[model samples]
Target chain A: MTDLYGVVPEPLAFAARDWGDLAELMERSSSDLGGQGVGALAPSVQAAASAFLTAWAGYAGESAAIARGFSSALDALVADATHTDDAIDTHFGGIDARLGPAR
Target chain B: MTVTIEVPASQPTIRRPEGQPGGSDTLAETLYTAASRYEEFADEADQLLAPRGFSGQGQNAYQAAGGKAAGEHRAMATTVERVARAVTAYADTLRDLLREWQELSDRQDVLDDRRTALIADINATTDATEAQIAALRERASALAADYAELVTDHDGLHRRVRANEDLLRQVFESATSLDEALSADGGVPEFAQQAMDRPGAPGSGATPEETRAWWEDLSEAEREAVVSSYPGLVGSADGLPADARDQANRVLLDDDLATLGSKADDGLITPAEQKVLDNARAAQQAMADADSFEDPITGERPGGQLWLYDPSAFDGDGRVAVAVGDLDTADDVAVFTPGITTEMSDVPGYTDQMQNLYESTRYNGDGSSVATMFWLGYNTPEGAIDWDTMTEGRAADGGERLADAVDGLRASRPDDPAHMTAIGHSYGSTTTSYAAADHDLDVDDVALIGSPGAGPADHASDFSVGQEHVYVGRDSRDFVAVLGDEGWIGKGGLGLGTDPSSEDFDATRFESEREDRGSTRLDGDAHSSYLAHDTESLYNLGLIVDGHGDQVNTASQSYDPWYDVPQDPEWDRDPSSGVPGQSQTRDPGQP
Candidate 1:
C-alpha cells in the first residue's frame, strides 16, 4: 500500500464550502444556454440571447463576493490560531517555572 | 525535602507569535490600496461602458458585453469595498494589541533595570560605612528629582501623542463617511449642502476652535467649494480663520471689481453706481501703486492689503477697509477710523496714513510684527461741515459695527490675540469712544486724534480700561475740538461730550503741533494733518499704537481758564473783537 498525506487549511475548507454552491449554480445556468448565432435573428431571439449572456455574467460575478467572504474568514481563523499559540506558550512557561530543574 | 535548588541564569525571552500572513501596518496599507484600486476600476468602467449601450448592430454586441462587464466590475467593486473595510477593522484591532504588547515590554524592561540597580544598591549598602550610605542617599534623592522631571516631560509628550491620535481618528472617520456618501448616485450635492449647513454656513454658532477643527477635517476641494459658493457667508463671519476670511474677501472683491468694471465699460451705470465703480477701481489702483509709496523713515514698501470691500454699501458710497501688514498674525494692530467724508474713494488717502503709521510703528517695534488697518466701515456724515448727523446718534450706530469688527478680529486670532488699539480721528473719535464707553469694546488701548469729545464719557476711566491706556492727541489750531466744549449749543452738547484732550477729562495728551513740513504748512488744516509725515502727532500715535506709551512725547498740562467755558458773546460777535487784524465771521454752532 502507498503512504498518502494531505493538508487542508481552514481557509481552503471555507472556500470549498462556497465553491460547491457556486459550481452547482453555474452548472445549472450553463445547461440553459441558447445556441443561436447573432446573424438575422428575430427581436425576441436577440433579447433572449442578451438575457442569456447577462445571466451568465451575473453567475460569474458571484465569484468575487465568494472570494471576499473567504478572505475575511481566513483572516479571522489566522488571528484565532495566533492567539491560541500564545496562550499555549504562556501555559507551558508557567509549568516549567513551577516544576523547575528535575534532579 | 532536601532537594537541590537551582535558579535560572537569565530571564526567559518572550517570543511573539510568528507566521501571521500580514502585520497590522502591512494589512492596513493593503486594504487602502485595494479600496483605491476598486474605486478606480469602478470609475473607469462607468466612463467607458455606461454611455455606449445599444447604439447600433455592431455596437449592440459590444454594448451588451460592455454592460455585462461594467455590471460585474461594479459588483466586484462593492464586494472588495466590504472586504477592505473588514480588513481595516481587523488591522486596527491588531495594531492596538501590538501597541499594548510593546508598552508591556517597555514597562518590563524598565522594571528589570530598576530591580537590577536596587539589588546592587542593597548589596553595597549592606557593607557600606555611614558616610557612604549618606552619599548614596544624596545620589538617590538627586535621581528622584531627575525622575520627576522625566515623568513631567513624558506626560506632556504622551498627551500630545494622544491628541494627535484623536485627530487622526476623527479625520479617518470623516473620510470614510465622505467616501461612502460620494460613492452613492447624486450624493455630491447632498454632501456639500450638509457640509455647508454644519460648518460652512455663517452664524452656525460654532466656536472658533470647533470651526477650525471642522475646517481641518475637510479636503482641499471641499474647502474650495465652500469658499467659492459662500463668499458672503464666509467672508464676514466671525470665528472663521483669518486666512480663510481673507481669501473669501479677496475673491468677493475681485468679482465685484470685475462686475463693476464691465458695467462701466458698457456705460450702463447710474451716476451713483459710476462713483462706486470708480471708487473700487481707484482702490485697486492704489493697491497696485503701493510699491511707489515707501515709508519716509524706513523706505520699506508698505503694500496695502484689502481686508473688507463692499462696492454697493451705504447707498453706493461704498464701504471699504484696508490693512498695511498681516493683521491675522501681528503682535500689534492699530485700526484707524476716519471721520468725515471718508468713503471708498478716499481709501487711498486713508490707507496712505495707515501705511505711514504702519511703517513707523514697525520700524520702532524692532522686529515686532505691526499691522495698521484703515477702517471705513461706517457711513460718515456726507459733508465735511455736517454737524447734525455727526452727533452721538450716528456714532452710537457706528459704534456697534465697530465693536463687532473688533470682536471679529479677536475671534479670528483667538490663539494669538494681538494688542489692538482703536484710533479714531474727528467724528470717528466719537464713534470709537461710543464703542468703548457703551458697547464694551474689546481693545488694549483707545486713542483719539483731533477728537471733539470722548463720546458720552466724562473721563478716561469710563471706557473700561486703565486711564493710562487712553491716549489723546489734538492740534490747538484744530477747530473741531472746541465743539465739545460748547455745552449750551446743542442737546447736551454740540458734539459727543467733553473733549478727551482736556485736562479735566484725565487722558494722557500727546503733542500735536501744527507746523510746516519744508515748503508745506499744515497749520489751517491741522485736524486732517495730524497724520502728516515727520510730525509729532504721527510719531506719538505710532508709539502709542506700538504699546510704547513711556516713549511718547507727552504734552505738558497747560491751564486754560476758558477751558470748557461757554464762548463769550463779545468774542463771537466779531472775530477781531478778541485780537486786532484777525477779522473773520464767527459761527459758534458750526462743526
Candidate 2:
C-alpha cells in the first residue's frame, strides 16, 4: 500500500524571499521615520515618511484587491463566465508581475 | 475291545450341509470317535509299561507301573471332555452367523422399497411438467389470437381517423371562410345579394374563397342569420383535427393495452407480468413521491425528524434535507455517496442505482430489515482548483454530521443489531474516505466507484471494520481513470488511482464486462456506469452488499455456473488477477 499522507512540495525559496522583502521594507520605513522629533524633523525626512506610508498603503490595498479579485475570477471561471481571463490577468497573474520586481 | 469293534463297523460318514447346523452334529460324532480311540491307545501304552505283574517284581517298580496306568486313564477322560466342548462352541458360532445374515436381508428389503417409491415420484414429476408445458402452449396461442384482434382493431381506428381528417379539414375551411367574410361590415341587402351570387359559399359548399366572397356580399341581417344557423358546424370544424387525432390515438393505444392485459390475465405470463407491473407501479410511486419533498411552502413531509446530516455542514431544519427510504426500520443500513457535485436532488435517482445491491441483501425480499440512504448531506464544492481542497469545510462538516447521525441511530436503536455499508461514487468516495478516516464509525463495508483521488490512509483503524477492506470498482472504459497516475496532479480528477481498481492498489476488484471499445466487453461511457453492468460490477456489488466476500470472485478470478471455472483464454490474466494498470506505475506511497 502506498503512503496515504503525502504532501505536495512547496517552493520554500520563493516564500522566504517574499517574507524577506516585506521585512526589509518594514525596517527601512520604521528607521527613516523613527529618529526625528515631530516638530524638528526635516521636510525631506517628513516627506520620506509620507512617501513610505503612501507606498505601503497602496501596496497593502493592491494586495487585498488582488486576493479578492482572484477569488471572484476563480468563481467566474467555475461558473463559465466570459470575463474569466481578464479577471485572472488583473488579479493573480498581474500581481506577481507588478509586485515581485518592486519587492 | 468293544469300542474297537464299534469303530470297525465303518461308522456312517457324518456329512454337514454348507449352511446348516449339521456341522455341529458332525463335529460331535467325530469327537466321540476320537475320544474312544484315545482311550484305547492309552490302555495299550499302560500295559506295555506295566507288563501285567511287574508291580509284584519289585516294590519301586510295582509303584511306578501303577502310577503310569492311573495317569493314562485320567488323560483319556480329559480328552473326551475337551472334544465335547469344541462341538458346543461350533454350534454357537453357526447360530450367530445366521442371525446376522437375516438382519442384513431386512435392511436390503427396505432400501429396495424406497428405491421403487423414488422412481414413481420421478415419473409423477415428469407428468406434471408435461401438463404445465401444454398449458403454456395454449396460453401462447390465446395471446397470439388476442394480438391479432388488437392489430385489426388498431387498423380500423386508423381508418376512421383518416376519414375524420377529411371532414375536419372541410369544416375548418368552411368556418374560416365564413369568419373572413364576417370581417367586413356590409351594406346589408346589397352585400347579401352579391355574397349569394358568388359560388362556393359555406352553405353552397364551394371553394372557401368563393364562399367568403358570397358571404361578403351578404346584408348584416343575412350574415347574422348565416352565423346563427351554422354555429355548431363552425365549432366542430375548428376543433376537428386535434379532437379527432386525440380520440383516435387514445382508442388505438387503449386497444393494444387491453390486449396485453388480457394476455397477462390468461395465465400465459401472469406471474411475471404481475411482477413487472408491480415494479413499474413502485417506480412510478417512488418517482411521484420523490419530487414531493415537502412543498417548502407547506412543510408537509411526514415524520418530521432529522434522519440525515453532514457533520461539518449546515442542516436544513424546516426544509427537506433528504428523501429517505427503508432507514426508519431497525435493520441493515446502506449509505450511498455520489462523487463530484452531489446534492439532495441526487437522492431521488439513487434508489435505482442500488437496485442490484438492495436485491442481493439478506433482508431484500422481506423489506423490513434492509434500509438504504443516499447521503447527499455533504456540501462538496461545485468546482475545485485543487481536488483535495475543493470542499474543505464542507467535507469536514459532512464527516462530523455523519458521525452524529451514526451515534444518534445507535443510541435510539440500541437493542437492534445494525450493520452499515457505505458506498461512494466518484468524488463522493473521497468524501466518504475522509469521513471514515476522521471519525470512528460502525461501517461494515466501504465501496468506492469511479474514484480518482486518495482513499483512507491516515486512519489505519478505519478499514478494520468487518474484516473486509474497502472495495473498489472501476471499468476500463471509465474516461476518468485515463488520467495518468500521479495521484491527480494540479487539478484533481475523479480520485481514480487510489482505488482498489488500480493494479497495485490491492483490494478486491470487480472488472466489468460492459465494453466501451473494440470487440471487448465494456461500456465505453465514462465514470457514469460503474454499477451498471449485470454480470461483472453489479454482480460483485450484490455480493458485497450481502456480505459474501468469501464467495466473490474478484477481478482476477472467474466463475462459471456450468463449469468449475471459466475457460475463456483471458480468464487467468483478466484484471482480477492483480495485474497493475498498463500505463501507470505502482506507487505504494499514495493511498
Candidate 3:
C-alpha cells in the first residue's frame, strides 16, 4: 500500500529509482570505456547528475501528484543537456539556449 | 503581483520573508533560465568553479537530458553572491570607522578616556571585518565541496568538454578518411568530426600523479612483460617516479585490447572520438603545470616575466649611504622610502637620509642593527603631475606598471620581510599612497613630505594606514601642497582634514607637534621645505621608520637630525619668499 503522505504511485513512484539507476549506468559505462576514449570518463559526470535527479525526484515523491510535473520538467532538461551541440548549432527554433559571454 | 510601500524601520510589526525575494524555485530552474537568457555574460567568476557546459548553453539539450537536474548549478552562484556581499559589508564597516575616527581626532585635547574608547572602536571594527572574512571563507569552502561532487559525477566532463574542441581539429586532419571512409560517399563530414583529428591538439593523457599511481599498481612480472613488449615505453618509464612507472606498466600489461574491441563494437571508437580523448589528456597536462605555483609575485610560469631589477650596484657605490638596520632591537627589517625624481643610480644617496636620522634616534643610537633600505632607484617621470593622469582610467597602465615594479621589489627582498614605510616627497607621496592601495602592500606607513594631492579613496579598506594615518607633511607657505583641484586634494589626496601650514592649525589636538614646518599645518615653502626643518621632521621620521607610534614633544626644542641647532624658523621659509629689502644667503653654518 502506497502511503498517501510519503510514497509515490506507479510510474511516478520509480522516478527517483529510475534516475538513480540511470546515473549508476552512466558511471559504469564511463569506467568501462576509461581507456578507449572519453566515454570512460562519463560515469563520473553522469553520477553527479544522477544523484541530483534522484534527490529532486525524492523531494517531489512526497506528493506524487506533483512528481509528474517535476519529472516531466526534468525529462525535458535531460533531453536538452544531451542535445546541447545540436541545439546550439541549430540557432533558430532551438529550445536550450547557449550560456556564457558573447563573441 | 506588483506592490509598493514605505515602512519605518522602528516598526515592530514589520514582516519579512524567510528566504530571499526570488521564491523557493529549485536551483536548477533558476541557473538554467538565467544562463539561457543571458547566454553571454561569463566573467572570471563563471570559470572559477568547475569548467564546462552551463545549462544556458543549450536549453533543449539540458531540458531533454533533465533540465532541472542540470540547473542545480544555481546553488553555486548563490554561494558566490553571498561571499561577495560579505566583502562589501566589511568595506562599509571600515568606511564608518574612518569617519568616526576622524571626528574624534579633531578635538583640541583628546582625553585619555576618549583615546581609549576610539582604539576600542577600531579594534571592534577590525574584528567585525575579520568575522566577515571568516563567513566568506566558509561559504567558499561549501561551494568548493559542491563543485568537487559535481566534478566526481561528471567524471571526465572536464576532459570531454576540452576533448570536443580537440576532436574538431583531428577531423580536419584526415580529410580523405573522414570524407569517404566514415560517410562512404564523399559527403563532407561535420566540423565537429574534422576538429577531432587535427594534429598538434591536446592528447588523451592522465595527470602525472595518476600516471605515477598506475605504475605503482602493477606487479613486477606484469611490468617486465609490458616492458619487453614496448621498448620505448619502458625507457620512458625509468625517469618517471615509482608510481608513474607502475601506472605505465599497468597500461602496457593490463591486456585492455578486449575493452577497445567492445568500445569499437559500440561505435564509440570513431576517429572523432579518438581525437577528443587525445585532446583531453593534453589539457590535463597543461592544467597540472599551471597549478604548480602559488606565489603571485615570483610565480612566472609559462608567461613572460612581470618585472625585474638588480640592486647589486648600490652596494658597491660608497657614495650611496647603505646601512641595513634591524628595528628597535627587534627582527623587523625596514625599508625607508625617500621621494622625488630619484634615478636608479641615486638609490645609495637616500640611504644616508635614513642613516643620518637613525643616528639621532633614541631607538637607533648606534644605527647599526636596523636594516634600512633607501629606495631611490625607481624611475619617476619628471614633470608637473596631474590627478587625472596619476589615477585610474588612462593612467591605469602606469598604475599597473608601478604595481609590477613594487611587486618585483617585494619578491626580490623576501629574506627581509620587515614592516616598511614609504616616505614620499611631493609627487613621490602620491605614488606611494596610490601604489599601497592598489597592491595591498605590507608597508606600515605612507609618510608624505611636501605632498600635493589626496590619498587613494578606492582602496581605503585594503590599506593598513587606517585611512586617517595616510600621514601628511606641509608648511603654511607651501603653495603646491594646499592647491585644490576637483576636491581630490583636500579629501582624497593628503588624508588630512585641514591645511597643516595654517597659523591656527591645531596639531596638538591629535597629540602631534606644531612647527613652522614639521607640523601637519601647511607652511613655509608650502612646496619645498621638507629637507630644511630637518631635525623635527627627521626625528618624527625616525620614530615612524622605527615602527613606533606617533610621539608628542611639548617643551621648547632646538635641534636637527644631521646637525644640532637652536630652535628657530630661519630655515623654515623658502629663501625666495622674503621681500626685496631682506637678503637671503645659503650660509655655511645654518641649515
Candidate 4:
C-alpha cells in the first residue's frame, strides 16, 4: 500500500492532451484546405464538401468534450486516493502512539 | 501528437478498442481475495496475541514487564488487523467503482458510434440531413445525462467508503482507550461514571438494544457498582436487560425492607410512616407465603420472586409486585393488574390468585415454565363501590407506570423473550387499556376481566394490540360492568369508555360464567368471582397465558343484550295512584 502511494497514473491525462492537440490540428488543416483547393469545386460539390467538414468538426468537438470529462474524473480519483492515504497515515500514527513503539 | 487526416467523401469508419483491461469480474475477484486474506490475518493475529496479553500467575517485576510488553504487542497487532480490514473494504469500493466506470465507458462508446452514424447520414442526404442532425443531438444529450448519473453514483460510493473508514478508526480508538483505562488502577469506576454521564443516560431515550450492548461491555464489578449505586436508574430504565433490572430492583427491595423494618422495630414513627412500614412488612410476608404456597394443580411448590416493591410509592398507598415463578427465565409470563381498592395489604390475596394462575398455566402449558405476577403497582381507588372512583384519571397515571414496568420486563429478558400477557382485573382493565392505547405498552396479549370499559377506547380495536389479541371476560350478572356504560345521572355517565365485553367493542369474549358449584353459589358472587378455583374464567385465562388462544372457550352468549334496556316503568308511576286508586274505592263493601 505504501509503495503505491503518490503514484497517479497519467494514461487518461496523456490521452486527453493528445486528443485536444489532434482536434486543433484538424481544424487548422481544414481551414487551410478550404482556403485553397476546395475553393475551386462546383457549387453543389462545394456545398456537399462543406457539409462533410461541418460533420467532422462536430465529431471532433464531441471527442474533445469526452476527453476533458475523462481528465477531470482522473483528477478527482487522484485527489480521493491522496486523501485516503493521508487518513491511513494519521490512523497508523495514532495506533503507534497507543501501542507504544512497534517491536 | 498531430495527425494530417483526410475527410471521407461519404462517412469515416468508426474505431473500436481491441481489448479492455481490468474487467469488472477480474477487479471484483481480486478485491474479494484481498478482503478474505485480511480477515484471515485478523483472526490469526487475535489467536496469537490475545492469550499473550493475559499475565501469567506471577506478580514479580520481570513478569510485570513481560505482561506490559505482551499487552502492547496485542494492541499493535489488533490495530494493524483492523486497519488492514478497512483497507480491504476501501479496495472493494474501488473495485465496484472500476466496474461501474467500465460499463459507463462502454455505453459512451455505443452512444458515440450512433452519433457518428447520424452525423454521416446528415451529410449524405440534404432532404434528411435536419432529422439526422436532430437524432445525433439526442444521442449526445443522452450520453451527457448518462455521464452525470455515473458521476453521481461514483460520488455516493466514495462517500460510503470514507464513512466506513472513519467508523473503523473510531472503533479502534475506543478499544485503545478502553485498554488504557483498564490498565490504570481504580480506573473502572471512573470509566463507568463517564459512560453513565454520556449523552444518553439510562432512562433518556436510549433503546433497549443500546442499553444491552452497554451493559454487556461492562466488567462484573462495574456492573455491580452501577446496580448498587443507581438501582432506581438501572431498575426502571427502558433499555436495560430484564435480568439486570431484576437484579437491581431486588437489591433495592431488600435494602428498602431492611431499613423500613429497622425503623419500625425502633418503635418511634408517625402514623403515615407506620402505614408504609406495615405495607412493606405485608409485602415481605406475601413473598414468604408465596414460597410456601403449594400449587393445587401442579402439586409443586414453585415459590415466588419479587420483581418490584416500593413501600413509599403513591404517598404511602404503596406499590408491590410478586411473581409466582422466576420471570427472567420463564417461557411464558402473565402480569395481572388488580383494579379498585388494591393496596400493599392485599398482596396475600393477589399473590394467591397469581399462584393459582401460575399453576394452572404451567399445568396447561405441557411442560413449559410459566410465571404469573400480581402487580399492585398503583394506588387503586379508595372505595370499591363508588361511581366516582371509576374515573379515567387514576387509570391514566397507573397506565404510564404499567407501561414502564412492561418496558423493564422487556429489558430484563432481551434474549429468549417471554411470551408476555397483561391481565387487567376490573379497574385494572381500564388502567391496562389506557397503557395499551396511550402509552403503546409492549405486551403480546391483553385480557380485561370484569371490566366496566377500556379507558379511552370505545372498541378493543382502538387499543394498540387490536381486537384480535384483546380478551374480555365479564359475568352476565356482574353489576360493576354496567357502571362503565351508565353515565352519572346528573353529572353524565361514567367516562371509562365502552365496556370491553359488549358486542360493539368486538373483543374475543372468554367464559367468565359463575354458576353454583355444589354448596358454593359461585355464580351469585359477581365481579370478583372470575378467579375462583375450577371456574371456566380461570381455565380460559390459563389457556391464554400459555399462548393457547385456540383452546380458550369463548362465550357464545352476549352480555350486552340484557344490559341495554330502558328505565323500569314502575319507577315512573304517579305517587298518588296507589293500586290505581282501588277503582274509586267501591269494591266489596259498597256491593
Instruction: Compute the TM-score of each model's chain A versus the native chain A and list the values.
Output: 0.44, 0.34, 0.27, 0.60
TM-score per prediction, in order, is: 0.52, 0.34, 0.29, 0.50
Scoring each candidate complex against the real one, what DockQ results? 0.01, 0.00, 0.01, 0.01
lDDT of each: 0.57, 0.40, 0.34, 0.57
Give the clash total for candidate 3: 111
Docking class of 2: incorrect
Question: Chain B, model 4, TM-score against the native?
Answer: 0.58
Candidates sorted on lDDT, descending: 4, 1, 2, 3
**Candidate 2 residue lDDT tens string, B50-81:** 33211233425533643553354335323332
Which model, 1 or 3, shows the larger lDDT?
1
lDDT of 3: 0.34
Regions of model 3 farther than 4 Å from truth: A1-103, B1-340, B345-349, B360-368, B385-417, B458-462, B484-534, B552-591
CAPRI verdict on model 4? incorrect
lDDT of 3 by residue, B354-443 (tens): 444433332322232333444433444444563443442322333343344344334334445455555656555555555665655456
Please identify model 1 stretches exceeding 4 Å from their true place: A1-103, B1-192, B203-219, B289-303, B384-390, B486-492, B517-523, B558-591
- Tens-digit lDDT track of model 4 for B362-461: 5556578888999887778877656546556788888988987888788767777888899999889999998998998888899989886788887777
Looking at model 1, give its docking quality level: incorrect
Worst 10-residue lDDT window, candidate 2 chain B: B1-10
